[model samples]
Target: MSSSAPWKQLLLNSINSNSHLKHSTYFQLATVRSNGRPSNRTVVFRGFQDGTDKIQINSDSRSCKIEDLKHCPFAEVCWYFTETWEQFRIHGRVDLIDASNSDPYKLEQREAAWFAGSVRSRLQYLGPTPGLPSLDEQPSHDSLDSSAGPVDVFCLLLLDPEQVDYLNLKSNERLAFTTARSVNAYEYIKVK
Candidate 1:
């Protein structure tokens, strides 16, 4: 096992990069349903909390993913950067930062996230609930009241990774790392 901070940093840097050509900010999130089926979807990457192992992503409070997380908090996220031919598979437990949480810090974080959202993005939470049968019609944006700020439906998903697998296709290298919640040190093993 290799506890290499630089390698982990490289992976984090790749994830945090802003290059459009790399598609670094998008990833596939996988969750398990109540019936024991796996579901996957693409989600945009949000910034991580400072000095913490938590990674953040936003979602509609009414989305299926929210319900899935409620039923089972564990999830896996896969991210690939074509430019570097590198992929990161993160195994983690999910936490929802929404109105239900009474923690002042978490509540503050949620508000910040809501305010940071673009008008168009924030409008999504204001529409008819997701995953419901619709009339084959779209909600007019003009009808939404943005002045109310983000609705209660806006949620932040905080993923606390238990393990992270980093693979570089270009170099034909793979490394698996395990994280300890109370320490910054990571233990890793090369898979290939």
Candidate 2:
């Protein structure tokens, strides 16, 4: 088997296993802050972008992470599967996929992503927005009754990975794969 086979298989397994589980898609996404520090947060793994090496994630357009990505596109994602004791660390550059983009393909993808969201998921984007302090002890969900449909705050983020490191605790093995974006090929090196 090729060196990247195990890594690819593991990643596919993780995604498949998490498909139906509500909380299984969570991963730690790290971005570079303006002060040269790293900012990390948990984000849901939407899926992989069609016909590309990019991984997809949904986000509120008003979130700080969006602003951070606008300033610095590079990011790293760390995902772990507790049941399998496997981990993947991916380094990549992010692109905001939203309605405002001039690319028709991207716009279509963004719309698809937005439509794929559940009612509860869509409601999250309609609130008082993320990262802002609320004076009220409990915010109301009355905005859900508005005539407007799902808010435009929904956005898709595509992470085009340059490198992926896979670690399997069960076998105590580590492998790193470098991806060629243009050719969609992987060259792997065993780190452990």
Q: What is the TM-score of each candidate against the true structure?
A: 0.84, 0.82
Name the lDDT value of residue 85 in candidate 2. 79
What would the per-residue lDDT of candidate 2 be over residues 70-187, giving only the tens digit for each residue? 8899999999887677889999899997657899888888877776655445666666756332111234454454334435777889998888898889899888988765674677
Look at candidate 1 and give me any clashing residue pairs: 2-188
Per-candidate alpha-carbon RMSD to the true structure: 4.7, 4.7
Question: Please, what are the lDDT tens digits per residue for candidate 1 over residues 9-64?
Answer: 87667755637553567789999888878999888777776556677898878888
Candidate 1 local Cα displacement, residue 136, angstroms: 20
**lDDT of the structure predicted as candidate 2:** 0.75
